[model samples]
Each structure stands twice: as C-alpha cells, then as structure tokens.
Target: MLWFNPRHPSFFYYNTSTANLKSNYQVNTNGLIGQTTALQSVVSWNKTITKCRQNSQIIKAQKLFDKMPLKDIVSYNTILPGLNQAKNPEKVCQLFLEMERVGLKPNEYTLSMIFSAALNTELKLLVSQIHARTICLALNASVFVGSALMKAYADAGDGVGLGKVFNEIFNKDVSSWNALVSGYMELGRMHEAQKTFDTMPDKDVVSWTTLVNGYIRNKRINKARSIFNKITEKNVISWTVKINRYVQSERFVDALKMFVLMMRSDTMPNKFTYSSVLDACAGCCCLLVGQQVHSSIMKFGIPKDVVLSTSLVNMYAKCGDIDAAFSVFESVQRKNLASWNSMIGGYCRHGLGKRALEEFERMIKMGVKPDEVTFVNVLSACGHGGLVEEGEKHFDSTETKYGINAEVKHYACMVDLCGRAGQLDKAEKLIKEMPFEGDVVIWGALLGGCGHHSNTKLGELAAEAISRLKKDHPALFSTLTKIHGEKGARSTVVTLRKILNEKRFRKQEACSWVESPFHEM
Candidate 1:
C-alpha cells in the first residue's frame, strides 16, 4: 500500500513499483528556472505550506498564505483542506469570503469542503445561496462543482431538492445521479429511491453502491440481492456493502456465504468487512459461523478492535457461548465502556443478572464510568434479581454519582422495580412525576409488574399510558386487552381494540425499514 509521509522532509513516499516519478519530475524541471524572486517562490512557498500544516502552525501558515502574491486554485485547495484538518470551518468560510472579495473563485474541492462543514438543516438554503453566488460571480459552471452541490443537498436529506438540482445539470454523470439516489436512500424513501435507480441511464461502481445501500436501508433485502447478483464487476467496497446489508437484515448465513465466496475469489477482507461479518454471525445467533469468523479474524492477524471484540462477546453470549464471549472479552488489549456494557446487557438480557451486575461493578471499580446504557443493564439485573433497594440506589446515583440524568429507560426501570415489589402506589406516582410521558416500555414494565402483584388500579393507569405511547408494540395492545378483561371494563377493551385497529390500518402503506434503533441500553 502506498502511504503518504507528509511528516518526512520529502513529504511523500510509498512502496510504488517504480521510483520513476522522480525521473519525470527532473525532466519536467530541466529547462525551467527553479527559483526567481527571493520573496515569491512557488516551490518554496508550497514547501512552507506543507510544513506549516504538518507542525500545525495555524497562525504562521495564515500569515504566509496572505503574503503570497501570485496564487492559483492549487494554492487555495492546499490551505482549505488543511484548515478543515484544523477544524475551523467558520474560519474556512472567512477564507472563502476573502477569495471571493478578490477576483479569485472556488472550485469543486472548495465547495466540497463547504458542504462537509455545513449544518444539516441549513444546507439546502446555503447550497442555493452558493449557486446564486457562483452565477453572480460569473464563475464557470463545472461538473465537479455541480456534483459537489448535489452531494451537499443529498447529505441534507432533501432528496426532492437534490433531484431538482440533478435535473438542472445538462451533462450529468454517474456521480451526480449517485448523489441523488444516495440522498433518497438516506431519507428511507424507498419507492422514489427505486424510481431513481430504474431511471439512471448509465451505471458505475458508485451508482451500484448507492442503490445497493438504498435497497438495504429501505429493508428491501431481496432487491439488494438482485442488484448485487447483476453487478458486472465487484470491488472491496461492493463486497463490504452487500455483506453489510445481509448482516443488517439479520441474515448471517447469507453474509457468511458472501464472505467465503469473496475469500475463495482471492478478494481480501479489510477491518471493516471483518467487523461487519462477525457482527452478522453474532446477530443471527450462528455460533458455528461466529467461531469461524473469529478464527478468520485471528488468522488475518487483525488487532482486537473494541467494536469487533465486543460484537464477538455479545455474539457468544447471544448464541449460548458465554465462555467464548468471556474469553474474547478477556483477550482484548483495550476495552471501552461499550465493551463492558455489551457483555453486561447480554448477560442481563439472557437471565444472567448476577453476572451482569458483577461485571458492571467491576467496570466501575476499574475507573471506567458507567453510562446510562450501563445503568439499563444493571437495572435489568435488579429486575431479575428483585434487588429493589439496590436498584433504587443505582437509579438515584445516575444523576448523583455519574452526573448522567435519568432518562425514560431509567424511569421505566424504577417503575418496574417499584411495581414488582408491590409498591404500586409509588410506581403510579413516579410515572406521573416523570419529567416526560413515559414510553411504551415503561408502561409495559408497569403492566407486567401489576400482573405479578395483581394491582388492577395501577394496571388501568399503565393501560392509559400505553395507549398514549408513540410506537405500538404487541405487548401494549395485549396488556390493555388483558387488563380490561381482568377488571371487567368492557368499554375500555373495545376502545383499545379500535385504536389498535386504526393504527394497524391507517398508517401509510410503506414497509417499515426501521430495525428498532431504539434500545433500552
């Protein structure tokens, strides 16, 4: 792999097959004067700019940048990317304004930098302003600039707006179309997204990747596979994207098949692909596949990445291989809070509450701060173990010890603990006193606790809360029906049934691509 060494005096070096670029450089500079004026030398100034950036001499670089007399697009491009590296987009904007105040103009790279820094909501407006500004400035409308604009609008989630931009371009290329399609995919507008994919006159790697990702994002896995099968060429990116989709759709067998095919074809897997494949096996509870993937990752001598390692741990735990999960966890050189939390969440989720709580405490004692997610797993431990007093102490410490405020899940845990312990009155009071209306989970937890305690009054309150929740789940509907029947409230049951029917039927015809991004932990 060719690596750029900007830190070295030469500023660039790599294991290329040849050192002949130096020969060409010498030949190109043979007849040309190397240096002219003492104060203005392009080669010297360029070198200075490179060093200034390498050393992070922000103020000095800006000064040298200002003193330069003869400059070009290359000059501006150099400083803009480095300015972005320094993470002062606001100052980068100032530099663009400075370039504009003079007769100089922006190119595609400049606009791309602007797009990378823009606020998501304000993007379309700002991009339009930019187009207007460019027209008013009489800068040549370049395809690269137009493509960058299309990307900016797409990234902003304005697919229709991006389409409008796409249609305006006369000689649109694959990148232009890809941007619009990618935009639609990001917004989960699969129907219109499919339309864009069908109408594209020409296709490239980017075009396929965009559509493949869109189909997967929209949960049109079959369509994604159809597109993947039809591809005339494949690259590492295509492999990763397709494998990732299979993983995302919770189809571990398909992911494993693709990985074996890629490996047999002599296509090497990178860190990203390895992580995704392992994640897929873990998600589908394919212990055999999980073990094979783990062996491959090890054979490749890939470092134990925290995300990859955690995925293995959780996968092993999920697939009833707690020993493997613990072994993987202990094997990693470094561990993040997510590493600790995943195993804890897994343990609690699978009824290993005691182990989960022990791991949580151990994490805290090691100077690792427990986040809200950690608390959620610990609460699950409390729920399973019936440690009501300890659950309260941990819940209260969220704000008191960790300075993390109690969220809806935390409140849900408290309601579950209290209601299960036969403190129905306090649970009801806590639900009402919650800073916000609790979600379906909190209500469901309360309902389950009431069923255990046989508190019909609190059950009624939970049913009401469930009815008001945003997302409908099987549990809430069933709980309300059971609660109404248990209390002999025929009217409430009829009302609840009507609401559930309405929700099921009146919601849009679009298939939900959502995979419950919401998590208790």
Candidate 2:
C-alpha cells in the first residue's frame, strides 16, 4: 500500500505494517486506497514521461501522458513545463483548466509555469484569472509564483498589474524586486525603475545590471555609467551593456577604452562583448587594436559562432584587410545570409568589383538567396567595374527574377554604371523612369557621371535638380563649377562660385588615422 502526503502531493510512502494484509488497502491524503503495485506503475510512467520531455520529445511525452491510466497533479505538472518549453500557450492553458476540472489542485510550480507561458498581451486576461486563482489557493505569497506573475504583467506592458502583484508578494526576494524594476524599465518609466533600485532591501548582480540596461535603453548612457561605476562587483553583462551602447552611439573611442578597462578588471569578454568591440575597431579603422582583440579571442579559446565570425569578417574588411575577411568567411562552418553579405560588401568596398561579382555568383551557386543588401553591393560592383550590361541585367533581375523591387539606391547604382560607361543619355533616362522621386543621392550619381564624361548640358540639369533638393550643397556647386569651367562658360562658373561664397560652403576635409602604440587616444 502507498500513501501520498497532502503537503507534498508528488511524494509517496509505502506502508510496511502488515496488519491489514488481506485487504491491501491504504489511506492517502486524497482518501484513496490502492495496491502498492499500481502506485509503482504510476511512478514508472511519470519517470518515462519526464525523460521524454527532457529529450525534447514533447509529442511523445504528450502521447504517454494521454495514455496514463491514472492522472494526478504531478502528471499535469510534468507535462505543463514541456508544453511551455514548446511555446504552446494554448495547450498550457487547456491543461491547467483540465487539471482544475479533474479536481487536481495545482501547486506553486504549475502556476509559475502557466504564468511564464502566458507572456504576450493576448494572454493578459488569462494571467489575471491565474492571479485570482493563486489568491484563492493562498499561493499568491509564494515568491516563485509572484515573480512569474510580475514578469508576465511586465512583458504585457501592464504597469498597474505588475505593481499590484509586487505589492501583494508577502516576502519579496531580490528576483521579485528585479521583476518589478524590469517591468518599469519595459514600460519606459525610468524614474520609477531608478527609485525601485534605490529602495531594494537587497540587491544582486542582476538587480544592478537590470537598472543599468534600462538606462541604456532609455538613451541615458551617462546615468547608466554612473550606476555602473557604483557597482562594487561588476559582471560580464554589466560591462557588455556599457560597451555595446558606446558602439551604438558611435562613441567607438569610448567603447575601446571601456573594453580596456574591462580587461584590466579581468572580466572575460563573451561573444556579445567581442562583437561590439570588433564594430568599434571597424568604426575607427583601428586595425592594430582589432588584431589584438582577435588574438585575445584565440588565446581565450572563445567559440567563433556565426555572429562573431560575421563581425570578424566586417571588421577585417572595413580595416582594408579583405584577404583576412575572406579567410574568416571561409572558416565559418555555417555561413548565414549576414556572413555572405559582409564578404560581398567587403569586396565592393576595396574596388575589387570583378571579385565581388564572382563571389556573389558563388553565393548564388551555394543555394544562398540574395537579399536587398546583397543586390545593392552587386549593383555597386557592376558600376565600379564599368559592367553596364551586367548591372542592367542584375537591375532587371531584381524585379523579374528575384521578386525584389529596385529601390532608389539600386537605381542610383544603375545611373552610376551608365555614367561610368559614357552612356549619359541612358543614365538620364534611368533617373526619369524611376518609380519614386529622385533623391539627392540619385541626382548626385548622375551629376558625378556627367562630370566624368564632360556632359555640361546634363550636368547643368543634374545640378539644378540637386539645388532644388538642397539649396546650398558645396559638392553640387563645386561639381557644377568644374563642368562650366571645362565648357568655357565663365559667366556660369562665376555665378556658381558666387553662390558657394554666399552660402559659406566648405567641403569637410578628408582625413585618415593610423593606430599608435599609446593605448589612450
């Protein structure tokens, strides 16, 4: 005979006493009697169901669960987590209701799983119902359940519901407090998030990190840094968040300095940290620092996943190291679309137009579909290499074959191709036939082509279109001045030069940087 404890319904105890041997009866908390053999069979079935779920065989687990002769709260609980893992929220809700209908009272674990599964706004009403049920079962005070409820409301963007759940928690732990703070952060209520952090009775690394991330998300980098500096013990996530924000804000120098500080503090850089650092290196063209970072990644034996590999390819390509970029691209075991795009873009950037086109063809032969970005690079490659026929073929294929509509940028590439090939009329016609209004870039491409081929008439038209878009563009005036000077139109040259002077237009001087031994720049 086996007896189940009321407080811990999942656990069973076998009766050793043989006083009622012939009857073979046992009394459990549920007031049910059964032979010990039947209880053993249930235990075996439960173990099998658990193993199936663990192996990601959720369908098998569900089938086994349905076939079980006896169903209890434990059986439902076991299957609920698998359903949640599979992201079948409807099934989770159905199972929960079924448990209720069968008089199987759910424990804290079941409620927590349900709350975690019902995350989106579509399940907001269901979350409220579960909250009410938790209260009815006197399980609302359970820290685990309360934290899950707080997170559900947080994800659903229900600030009031999240705050109410937080207040109702009997003994709030750091996780519950973090949930509340995270909720406020998600709602973009930074002041409340900060206040909650200020009043946390106890704070963990996650608590501090959450507040910092919230500030970063709200574009409050200075405040996030101030809080980060206050943390006595900083973890990898904290450092990564600060560094990533710097990279995003184009503060590449600051991002590098932070990476140096993170290394000084002996905090290991994860894949995300490395990705941001590589981007910073690419932004400033700091090849030396990028090389050192790459060495450290190898020294630390970091796994080069597809994302990190793509970043490496981009950094190398941007740093004028196309060979190295190609090497990294080759090493990527699973080349995704991003990896292919980075490699192709690198080739186009280096004036290796033929190589870029070849690689694009290779990417296609590998069964990789080209995206809009891929086509942009491809068209640019054709323009740079003076492959006008190839460029037109690709431009036509964008709509006819690939189903990708030609954007303005693609059309600009086509105009540049025709202009480079001394086909001024074709370039002008391409601009006129564009589906949308030609922007400054489209006109700029045609103007560049006209200047190259000394087509003063078309150059004048392009300059006029550019002036309508931007009244005082220095490049537009400068290019027009050159075209008029070449045509011996002194009066027109004087007028363009006078406009340049009146607008106080000065082209930004181009400069380059070389990496120095000094770490602090």
Candidate number achieving the greatest TM-score relative to the actual structure: 2
List the global CA lDDT of all models.
0.72, 0.83
Q: Which stretches of candidate 2 lie over 4 Å from their true place?
A: 1-189, 196-207, 217-219, 501-504, 507-521
Compared with the true structure, what per-residue lDDT tens digits does model 2 show for residues 1-521?
34355765545444445453322134553533443556678778889999999977788999999888766667888899999876689899988887776556789999988888887737766778788999999998888988888888878777998999999988888999998898899789998998999999999988988898788777888988898899999888889878887888788998999999999999999999999999999989999999999999999999999999999999999999999999999999878778999999999888899999999999999877787999989988887798988998999999898788888778878887888789999989988888899878778788877877788999889889887877666777877888888889999999988988998988533210001111111
User: Model 1, 463: alpha-carbon shift in Å?
Assistant: 3.1
Tens digit of per-residue lDDT, candidate 1, span 1-521: 11222333222222234543233134233222322232135456767887897766666786788787545445676777677765567777777777665445676677777766563534345776776765564432456766676667766666666676666666777777787778778788777777887898998887888898888878888888888878878888899888988887778788888988888878788778888887877777788887887888889887778887887887788788887788889887778787998788888767788999999888888777788889988986887787888998999899988788899878877877776687878777888899886777777777777766656777767767665664565455656566677778899879877877876734332111111222331
Model 2 pairs in collision: none
| Off by more than 4 A, model 1 | 1-152, 164-177, 187-203, 260-266, 361-372, 396-405, 467-521
- Per-residue lDDT value at 308 in model 2: 96
What C-alpha root-mean-square deviation, in Å, does candidate 1 show against the real structure?
Answer: 11.1
